[model samples]
Structures are given as C-alpha cells and as structure tokens.
Target: MVPAIESVGIGRLATCLREAGLLLLLALSVTVAAWLIRPEKMSLRAETAFYELELDAPLIAVADALVLYDTGSHLFLDTRTAGPGSFVTIPGALPVRVTTFDDDLYENRDFLYPEDPVVLFGDGNLPAVSDVAALLLERGFEEIMIMGGDLEAWRRTGGPLADHQAGEHE
Candidate 1:
C-alpha cells in the first residue's frame, strides 16, 4: 500500500510539472512573436510609417516629451500653423501659441534646455513638424521629434484636445 501511494504521488507531481513547463513555453513563444511583429521601426522624421497616434506617436520620442512636461521643462507644440491648422491635441498638451512660439522660443528663449525633448506635431504628412524639429535642432535642443500623424490621429485615439475653440480653459 505504501508503494502504491508513493507511485500515485509521483505521477501527480510529474503531471503538474509538465503543465507548468508547457505554460512557460507558451508564454515565451507569445512574447517572441510580439517582439518580432512590432510595428514600423521608430523614425526620427515625420514622413515614415502610417500615421496612427498623436498623443503617443511612435515617430515622436513620447517618453522624452513626458519627461520634459513632467519636470515643467519642455513644450509640446502643434506645428500646423499653415493650411487649416490642427483640430485636436493630446490630452493636457499645452499649446505653444503663436505668441509664445514666436516670443518665447525665438526672443525670450523661455524654458530652453538643449537636452530637453521638444515635440512638434501637425496634420498627416505635413512639413511643419519637420520644420519645427529642424528649428529646435538649430536652437540647440538636443532632442527633437515630430509626431508623424497630426491632430487627427490624436482625436481618433481619444486623446484630449484643448478647449480653446470652445472657450474653455486649457
């Protein structure tokens, strides 16, 4: 009887171990597939990849932008000053209004940190984003990125848009 009981316990233990091993392998396989099929490589320009997110554009170093804003050191601007202009924005995204963009960035140089990430956004495939990136580079902004997709993608993703047009305080 003792031997029979011992054999049953061993069988159960072996079954549990097999199940655990299978689960681990399955998880590992899924992780590897996710890594391999990840979307287009991160681009530094506004021209590459299908426009998807404004609040979290892959083309933009969104992580850096968060760092800058969290520390009160950086500015996110809608670069769609030409054509029809931007229609939405990432939630809580502060405007680099024409007045400030002109005076603050150009004349006053407010919040100037060469290392800070300056993110510029605009409409799909617009040139303004790249222009801002270049200008910031010239201004010694060590990190600059253009959100590949403009405000449309932002709005579609339920990203917060400023209430400027609605007369609500941003």
Candidate 2:
C-alpha cells in the first residue's frame, strides 16, 4: 500500500513538472514573439551610411606636412595621448585627445573646415591617427592626411614644438 501511494505521489510530481515546463516554454515563446514583432527595429540604411563613410585617409610625408603647416591654412590635429614622455607636437596644432575625440572635435568645430586640408599626427599611434582621420572624413572633411612620421620626426623636421610639453609617459 505504501509503495502504491509513493507511485501515485511520483506521478503527481511528474505531472506538475511537465505542466511547469510547458508553462515556461509558452512564456518564452511569447517573449520571443513580442521581441520579433517589436515596433522599433534597427535601421539597415544607417548601417550602410556608416559603411559608406570613407575611412581611408591619404598619407602625407613629414616634409609635405611641414609645407602645409607653413601655409597656416591647413588644420593640424595632434591625436596623441596627452600626458608624459618626450612627445612634442607641432606648435599651434589643435590638440585632440584620442580618449575624448568627439568632445574635442565638437569643441574645435569652429576651426574645422570641411574643404580644408586636415593633417593628423600622433606619437607612433597609427590607429589613433587612422581613427581620427576616419572621423574627420565622416564629418565631411575633404582632405584628411595622416602624417607618415612620428612626433620625433616632426620635431626633427623643423616643426616647432608647443611651448608646454603634454606630460611624461609612464
């Protein structure tokens, strides 16, 4: 009789478990259906527009950069990390911190001309230069040039350094 009662309890437990599982499955299916039919969806056109933005910036030798620098019309953007180490940037160049790129760009938007040449340089940070160049291109900057040399090269090429050093690198 005890065994018979135990089997009956086990059957009830199995039925509860099966029903619970079915309920959970139903809930999950409803959640997924709602997500699939959500009103707001990501726009593929925006992604395509972003892909269409030209990310390849032309390279400009240090010598050519020097010439453009002398013209005083071209905008020189220093995208090097600010702080420490013997990093010297071109005098009068706009300092754009790689970490705060968007804010720096917005702050200096008045100085930016979409049609003017924008020279970008960094202290052996090629990615930073390329990223900044891409952002400039996205902002409608026509001529974005990544300086082919490092800050030391710029310093050697008679490119005057700013009066204050950025800081020291650790």
Give the best candidate by TM-score.
2
Candidate 2: which stretches are off by over 4 Å? Answer: 1-55, 84-87, 165-170
Q: Which residue pairs overlap in candidate 2's backbone?
A: 84-167, 84-168, 84-169, 85-168, 85-169
Candidate 1 least-lDDT 10 residues: 161-170
RMSD of 2: 19.5
Question: What tens digits encode model 1's per-residue C-alpha lDDT throughout 69-115?
Answer: 46755456655543333444554444443324545354324444567
Residue 138 displacement (Å), model 1: 0.7
lDDT of 1 at 92: 45
Q: Write the per-residue lDDT of candidate 2 for residues 1-170, one digit (tens) a residue.
A: 35644555888999999999999999999987877885433333554433444436877778779899898868888887676644445776776766877877777767766887888888865666888787777778888888877878777776777654543111
- For model 2 the TM-score comes to 0.58
Candidate 1 CA-lDDT value: 0.54
Q: Which number leads on lDDT?
A: 2
lDDT of each: 0.54, 0.73
Task: Give the true-structure RMSD of model 1.
Answer: 9.8
